[model samples]
Target: MDLFQPSPSAHPGPELPELLPLGPDGIVVRFGRVVSPQLSAAVLAFEQAVQENLPDGVTEVAPSLSSVLVRFDPARGRRDQVLTALRKLLGGVDWLAETLPPASRIWHVPVCFGADQAPDLKTFCQLAGLSSEQAIAQITQTPLRVLAIGFAPGQPYLGYLPPAWDIPRRAALTPQVPAGALVAALRQLVLFNHASPTGWFQIGETAFRPFQRDRTVPFALKSGDSVQFHAIGSAEYSALKNRSDGLGGARYEAGA
Candidate 1:
């Protein structure tokens, strides 16, 4: 069965936080099929809980939009043993009601949303029924949470912009977008850490380097961190283009 999908025949019980094997050495703890802040909270809480109380053989815990992937060492323990430990841990608390962890950091990243930096800006503005200026205002006005970091090293998925921005991903792919490209779709924004092909519309560009191998912490943004984007002129973006610091033109606070 497709473990990720909701199949009544595959899982008849009403109990949630379901467990499905992800192969011999991994298990997927699914909170639900939908993606929302509350679900994300549960995933984060469970991830933290697992980290604090891992059974033998468990090697890693990674949280995604609505689930946690628990990987383990097959030689250390059997899947049933790990499942038993997870079941016990899951029973210890009501994870669904758990609040998000405290914000670890806050970032104010600068972006240039103009035509030159963002070639697809006009296209997206048209689709959202927004003018160029209006689009920039909407995107920069609020701070989005760093929901998850994937697709590329240190790349962040940030979102839940107003409903009007709840657009779908493009039908066709854009051959390539450079590192630091800011794209939008599904009411979320993705800040690319490296050049890549994508289906999301390119709406802006930033100088921030989310991943820097030279840094002690290669990934700049952690999952629970907050990020607010501010607009910058072309000249300013040019000035901040490639500074020694990997932050580009972004500034951050230690704690939320």
Candidate 2:
């Protein structure tokens, strides 16, 4: 099946969304209570629609796991007018049939797994009932989609791993995982963009810096993009670390 195509055996149709006020200047269009590929696709489609045909006062449109948050100018775009326009737009479309925006890109990221870099590898193997090599193989084989970018700057939540890889977060937080740490939890993978404490299991480390403060385009990834992880040796990791391009050793191809 196409990645963006909703599974008919699973999801019947595009979910109905609720447009609720987010204070006076913002409105949130929530698709559902849970996260799924179908819901994420809907959220992306809705966000694209809003951005392409923004109402008079709409200033910003942001997509999350299952919703789109739209910010508008209250003075120029009254709440009722903005809501009405949004509703009209929503009423005219079939979200499941909409295509992802053209701006999406696919990324191939190199990771060094199961060493000093991946402190939680043993723990992850224990929980997943897999050996160290098996765990690494499983992760490297799957191509995960970027569900959303939040929780930190340019930090992407990527996934929909197979059933066997649906691992939960650690009960306790790790003091700190450095930027580019490839962590996993709740069936999703997160590429840390900043050094921060996390409850997710750190399975690998990469040189890719998704958020570069000095770059013209600060965020290297976006929602709806696909991420394929490949294992790298310590020597290659060190070589990539020395480069100054700031993308680690990763490369990109433009498409859905």
Candidate 3:
């Protein structure tokens, strides 16, 4: 027997999600208008469910900060049929109550937050009304969650800093921040996976490379993972930077 019978007209319940079509073969299931842990959890749960019990014709499922993007094989399934299947799947679960997907790890990343390593540290401290040591202490003391991966390949958006640390992006963009640059803004921190322009305040730099194209697993971190940043000195940073193995002296623990 089929796991689920397709309804002639799929109607979403009170907690119904908004289904927005993307191009011809994609659909975005938006859980809420804003980003939150609950929304992220819901999106990830729905993403996992879709990946595990994909209806006919779905090709890929990608989770975002607050939504899931499902791609379909147009030749194999009509849009309406896919939508019906997705609606049924969405209605089947209590999204808000869903737990985060497993295999989440805690990564201890070594960062050099000295003035030479972090060009914007002074500015960041000025804005946050903290001394350099205080700023570093505040950042390093907290373990941040991997909220979403975007902006660059393997670049993770980690966050939920205390309200006092909720700083805004710079008015102008820095020409470019190299890979492994630790930047922060709006209560979230982003470790740059590759050189890119950014408006976020560059607070530190890590030798750890999260994105290794040649490696079997290109991305070292995933959404729902925890990241704890620890301060390191120039000598250690240089030593780790010279190593060719490519993990950049970062350590990982299985459970978060």
Top candidate, metric lDDT:
1
- Compared with the true structure, model 3 gives a TM-score of 0.84
Q: TM-score, each model?
A: 0.84, 0.85, 0.84
- Write model 2 residue lDDT over 147-181, tens digit each, in one string: 78898889898876766667877778899998889
| TM-score ranking, best first | 2, 1, 3
Worst 10 contiguous positions by lDDT, candidate 1: 2-11
Identify the runs in model 1 with alpha carbons over 4 angstroms from their true place: 1-14, 54-57, 74-78, 92-99
TM-score of model 1 (CA atoms): 0.84
By lDDT, highest first, what's the ranking? 1, 3, 2
Highest TM-score: give the candidate number.
Answer: 2
lDDT of 1 by residue, 1-256 (tens): 3433344543344455788888778999989898877888888778878988989999988888888899999899888788778876776466778888766688999999767789988888788898888888888997788878887788899876777777788889999998889999678889988889999989999999999999777778877788989999899998888687778878789764
